[model samples]
Target: MVIDTATTSGDTALKQKVSSLMSTLKSDLCDLVRIRSTAGGATTEAANKVVSLLKEAGVSDATTVKIGSGRAPLVHGTVTGRTGKPTVLLYAHYDVQPAGSWNETEAFTPTEVNGRLRGRGAADDKSGIMMHVGALRAFDKNPPVNLEILIEGEEESGTGSLEEYLAKPENKDRFKADAYVVADTGGIAVGRPALTATLRGIAQADVTVRTLDAPVHSGMYGGPAPDAFMALTRILATLHDDKGDVAVEGLLSKPWTGADHPDETTYRQNAGVRCGVPLIGTGSVAQRLYFKPSINVTGLDGAPPPVHKSLNALQSEATARVSIRLVPGQKPADAVAALRRHIDQHRPWFLPVEVTYAGGGEGFEARTGSTTFAKAQAALQEAYGQAPTTLGQGGSIPLVNLLQARKPDAPVLLWGCEEPAARIHAPGESVHLDELERMTLAQALFLKALSQQ
Candidate 1:
């Protein structure tokens, strides 16, 4: 998988320039990860820092755009390229998921260990921020293709602020590009680059069940008491059949036709499944995970935390947060409606069931046959020294759908510096240094290839 950059002297030179900036890359990555940019935290600070870094990295027109005073502003800037060259918009996010606790170091404090950087936003997106910066710096600020930076400040929260910003008529021309590179997705494995071809959408609800007016003593009404928790559990049990496939009516499932899905053993290890524990669901792990609807009880309220002890009475009411991930071509609203209908049909013991519809976003399916996609394939292969794989992400990237809707002609490529071992959104989140560097090279090569067209 030697990169076919021999015919392009500038592209070959860009690779060397990126390699020379390894130390600077790590420094910038660690600095970006150290900012506490969680959804509820000071994301404005992170956004401002990204703007400043972009300016320092050669983007002379870097600036922050804020819709409101309290909202985290988006960072937008550009590096002018040769006349008549195509413009490439690089997209990433600064906001990170909530970090519960840390293992080796504090969530906000980036720690480097054995070629990995560990922190809250280190891999999920802070590394994404640096990956773009490294790529732009490789071209000395002005890439072969005109470069546009649109680092969103609130993507994880799914507020769609950036989408709204881009929708405005005045802002449309400012951010318009021939191609979009979303650096928020990860490779299949470290050093194994992958272009995400699809993303699954999510729908959620807080379901409650009430069976009694008040708590009853277990000793007096142990068998006869209509416990709300028991009834709620029964209703949830109907979500999955004996084969572990989702049993909800009207939901959709399809076979995955791209990329190499993770093997059962790798999936188990990544999920930390206990020894001898059978994997749930039917079909291949990728099919069940990426191409089928899945239900999960994310949170249960009014339950004892196991550290506390109170087991004498039957509770009168119970609530659980149910999250459902919908595959591509499945509408989020339809899935939500189907789930509500399923709950209605499976009310245990005719108990009162209440379902509240939370918000959800639409999934994305990429077109792999486009010209920009071909350039991306070549760029990724050149950067990784191996052919890249095409895969679909099970997580939702709502903005991808918005981008497609607004600019259907522009192809979107999803690639980034994280891998499964990064543990994004969980404890011990980290980024592989090599993946970050290679992604930087890939973006540089991608821009050069697109420019030649």
Candidate 2:
């Protein structure tokens, strides 16, 4: 997309200019997609290339700050502009989910076809980060407002340290801003604009049931001995009632009023639900996924034998991993506590069960009446020539909430380069050129309008 070299022009003219610069956008974006930034010990040589690009983009203050051992570096870039205007901090993660085997399509090779760019980082967020750079470049890499960019590297593993980096004294003070823009969300579908205003928090625990010392032969003690796997499965069965509602108490439940979710056909096409089974539950998709708690069985251990033909029967221990997605108003700690108590209270046949807290994060919901929200919504609708769908995302970005706490006076806007059909977190992750161009226009117009305000 082309940024009009001239300033203070009409929105339509600027959009035309951005549309004309498509070649440059793809060329510049390719440099970002070639990197591997998964959360781990070693720094990716490709991520260093991204660091250089930010430097070239006139981010005068740029550095890679390390988290604890085993966490990848967080790339930070800051540029201070006119003092009277507001500051905007942009959040994105550079690290990608691991790319599994590919016979013909290599994980590192970024490809473009049918107006779509495909690769590991194209959608799940290197290109989104590139949108940040594109926005900065469209505005000459130095807009009317002060800005800070934080690109993280530990998102895939779910061991977030960007929050910790933001909490550090030196970085925390410098990272303060009036508004934070987290460009990590996706459009509802191709050409369907959206803004994610709420995110469900997460809590995880391991629940174990130990009914016997070791494997007991079924013939010797079958009917009388309590089976650990059966007990564990029974306890798990109680987590969700027949209607698929999470049965735990005090975890919080509420009706969702944000936006109408797409029908099952859309969900199946996006998720590739090949088995043709309808999604569970009769409630609104938004209510079931975002505003209410969801319990999932992540992993399990014991009772079942390996793939062999052994005759040993079930006995000893059973462990199951449980994950809860809490609504905006629920705290992770409170949910975890309630989950533990509920599990303990519902044990089968007086069997001993243990619940251990694993991990968690608090949910977030934002008011849509802010000036920033108006500016974004107007720009999105104007650019795409369609009404923007306001909705809630099902996942969490831990640092965005912290940014809200640190900068309470400003509104945080969410937009991005991804779309639901991009197949994010899976092979063939991609970005449509049309959506990227529209987003560039939206961001350009939003920034200009914001600067006006």
Error of 1 at 182 (Å): 0.5
Write one digit per residue (lDDT tens) for candidate 1, span 1-453: 233434367767877899999899899888888788887787888988898899988888899888643388888888774699987788999999887765424888888999899999999898889989998788776677777888988888767667666567776655667788899988888988899998888888889988678888878987887888888889899999998989999988878877657889888998899999999888888888788888999889755336466677887889998889988788777888898899999898777799987767777889888878988888888888888888888888877776776578989888898789999999989999989889999888888788778
TM-score of each: 0.92, 0.88
Off by over 4 Å in 1: 1-7, 68-70, 80-82, 103-105, 163-174, 212-225
Choose the strongest candidate by TM-score: 1
Off by over 4 Å in 2: 1-13, 41-43, 100-105, 167-174, 211-228, 274-276, 301-315
TM-score of 2: 0.88
Give the alpha-carbon lDDT of every model. Answer: 0.83, 0.77
Counting only residues 3 or more apart in sequence or on different chains, how many pairs clash (N, Cα, C under 3 Å) in candidate 1?
Answer: 0
Estimate, for each residue in 269-315, the C-alpha lDDT of model 2 and write its tens digit: 77787885767766877677778888898778885876685665865
